[model samples]
Target: MLEEAEFDRDDAAPIDMLESYFAAHGWSHERDDDEIVAKVKGSWAEYELRAIWREDDNVLQFLAFPDVRVADERRATIYETMGLVNEQLWIGHFELWSTSGILLYRHAAMIDGEGGGTLTLDQAEMLIESAIDECERFYPVFQFVLWGGKTPKEAIAASLIETQGEA
Candidate 1:
């Protein structure tokens, strides 16, 4: 459950901390009044990280995604892949934004107050790392579907084959 009382932007927005976090990581980012967008490079892909402060809802919404574009023709298969991928262990989930044709990982944390928990710098890092890690782990499945023309089932099956020791 979450409280619905409106909060002042200054009091509720954690944009400053978020900015500081991005700076500490040395990632290029831009911040507006209530949102920060950062560019992150991971092992498997480059990602766009977006965090929005919702004062009224006391929620911090975070989204991170690789630069893959989902075409309209493949949207249904991608959605099916999203469902299969989401069924595995998860903190956040993948979504393909229909209008934008972008696939992203999204998670939200309740920031301080009644019914809202706290968000420390460490927790924020964990939250972000979780998203990126999931993206890295599953990037191949998405690719298999979009580029390799594999069905949702086949894509996930191919990704799950744990290879032997590295070459």
Candidate 2:
């Protein structure tokens, strides 16, 4: 499990460690108070992912909002598809903001107490990489459903179908 790893906090905020990790990878990010926001470019879209450190709650919240907006007419279908997608996801889950009709992926990593748990660089990288990869892989499926008028099952099936060059 992603959250099962023991991180050595060393009495520092997890958010600070996250900032350093991003810097080490040459990814430019902005830190605002307790939150860090970074823009990531993917194959299909540019994503803005935010990591917020909730010190009092001992949790690090990560959120990614794709550039696509769920059309009002397609909201129902998208919601249904998201439910199915969430079931297959191991770490984070996709959710729709009802008011804005925006789809977002969210995952929270628990930091045990003030000095019990630590967020290692590897674990942090895993969390970010998994989220970005999943979004990149499924983004096309979302477009198929919203614009191509395909059913949820059909969309998923089409997305999972991989093509290979002649070998």
Candidate 3:
């Protein structure tokens, strides 16, 4: 059985690290009120990378898709199947960060049955990249990036995100 973990919003925001990561990689960060949003678009329409940092720990990231938008569609089904009525599952990489600048967890939109647990920074990086590599099976062209602590939403989202392309 999975052990229940405590989630504190004041100690786990991954956006701080993300901002540093992007800047180190030559991406710029644009502040938008409480959210910091950024986009990198290449010649190919599908080569765009969009990301947003909201509050202390909510980071949403997404890669543009040339084909059907799989995240939105899959998320709708998952929400309906699980009977979630209060939240909207938008397409892309949706992540919620806690306050400590650590990636409490993350997941993609649409692909349900995500799996996650507390992880070190290195572990989080590896898992996130692995999740992206597996996206082809579920959404021909989809990539989601997320950052967040273990809130209920984050937990559920993480599970669904991990299950996206599993056999």
Q: lDDT for each of the candidates?
A: 0.81, 0.80, 0.33
| Winner of 2 and 3 under lDDT | 2
By TM-score: ranked, best first: 2, 1, 3
Candidate number with the higher TM-score (1 or 2)? 2
Listed in order, each prediction's TM-score against the native is 0.84, 0.86, 0.30
Question: Per-prediction count of colliding residue pairs?
Answer: 0, 2, 20
Candidate 1 stretches with Cα past 4 Å from truth are 1-13, 114-118, 163-167
Candidate 2 — which residues are off by over 4 angstroms? Answer: 1-12, 114-117, 162-167
Clashing pairs in 1: none
lDDT (tens digit, per residue) of candidate 1 on 1-167: 11122222213236766676677678999999889999999887889989998988888899987888998988999999999999995588999887899999999887876634345655566777788888888999999999998999999999889899989
Q: In model 2, how large is the Cα lDDT of residue 38? A: 83
TM accuracy, model 2? 0.86
Q: Write the per-residue lDDT of candidate 2 for residues 61-90, one digit (tens) a residue.
A: 998888778878889899889987887889
Worst 10 residues of 2 by lDDT: 1-10
lDDT of 3 by residue, 1-167 (tens): 11113222211234443444345445555654333333433332322233343332333343323222324424433333223312333322323122322111124322111222112234334433433332332221122222222334444454455445657
